[model samples]
Target: NLLHEPVTIASVLSVPTVKENLEYVIHSSASDRLKIDGIGFIGARKVHLYFDPPLVKEVAYEDMSAYPLTENQIILRRRHGYTWRELLGPLKVIGVDTGAGAVKVNGEDGVVVAQVMANINVALSTANTQLANNNKSHSAPAPGASVPAGVGGAGSDFLNDLAEKKKTV
Candidate 1:
């Protein structure tokens, strides 16, 4: 089961802009992973996310999809870092290490559902939470605090909805 294994960031791509030519690089952790779509490396950067150092995330899942056979989505349970309350969901699953190969149960087998999340949605949701917290915390952010996307007044309604959904989870 994926939940049995430790899921951590494998690689991070700093995409300064969409126009920038991105070179394909395979992250070592899931280098041998396989899928019907194609090799994982081509879209590797898009899948992996970057988190600040020392900030470990807590993972949570809402439901499992039976047909596709995976968890509905990854939920951020808690944040671990210097200023965590300011952060949103701790879990953001990038890629599954299918290359690691699966262990078999000699006697019987059971279905295992894995969690999944899109790179954009997870990021926007987290940013939405961060922005909301920023409003409550220090009236003025520390000098040069990096501004995440959706900074224009609490982001879009979808973002607000995402923030609300996160709270319920």
Candidate 2:
């Protein structure tokens, strides 16, 4: 039950050999974790660009057939949504130290490891929390409570059901 919308943005690569650009991008899935490199442009929205980056070998699950794969090889499924910046605004970048510059490690010289970009969209930011604005209108059902197709009830109903079920067991 996830929805994905198309988006775009500008991004730079960590690699010195590559050039960066602004391009249209499509966002999908639950977690919204996508390979910045796998994205492409859509239309006049050239300003909408995908952030591509190099990949390193890490264990991950490649498919559903292997449910609950090892951590190193696990690819957790994600809900689709737009990145935070797309929904909110340009995110401020921070500085980071990777110990060695691109040149020092790859033979170039004097490079810095910039802060990792975090997609803090409206759906992800703390601002969207259920406790934030008190979103009681679309509140989720409690555990063990069978909610009718479109019925509303107090949250206690769910907990009551769970208590009854526990007693029977």
lDDT of 1 by residue, 85-135 (tens): 133322112223222322221113211112122335445655775687773
lDDT of 1: 0.29
C-alpha lDDT of residue 14 in model 1:
25
Candidate 2 lDDT over residue span 1-169, tens digit each: 2448655555432322211213423222223332221111111111111121221122211222132212212122223333323332222212111112222221333222122243345336434544554764333334444556335555445445544576566
* Each prediction's whole-model lDDT (CA): 0.29, 0.29
Return the top candidate by TM-score.
2
Q: After best superposition, candidate 2 residue 135: deviation in angstroms?
A: 11
Off by over 4 Å in 2: 1-29, 34-93, 96-153, 162-169
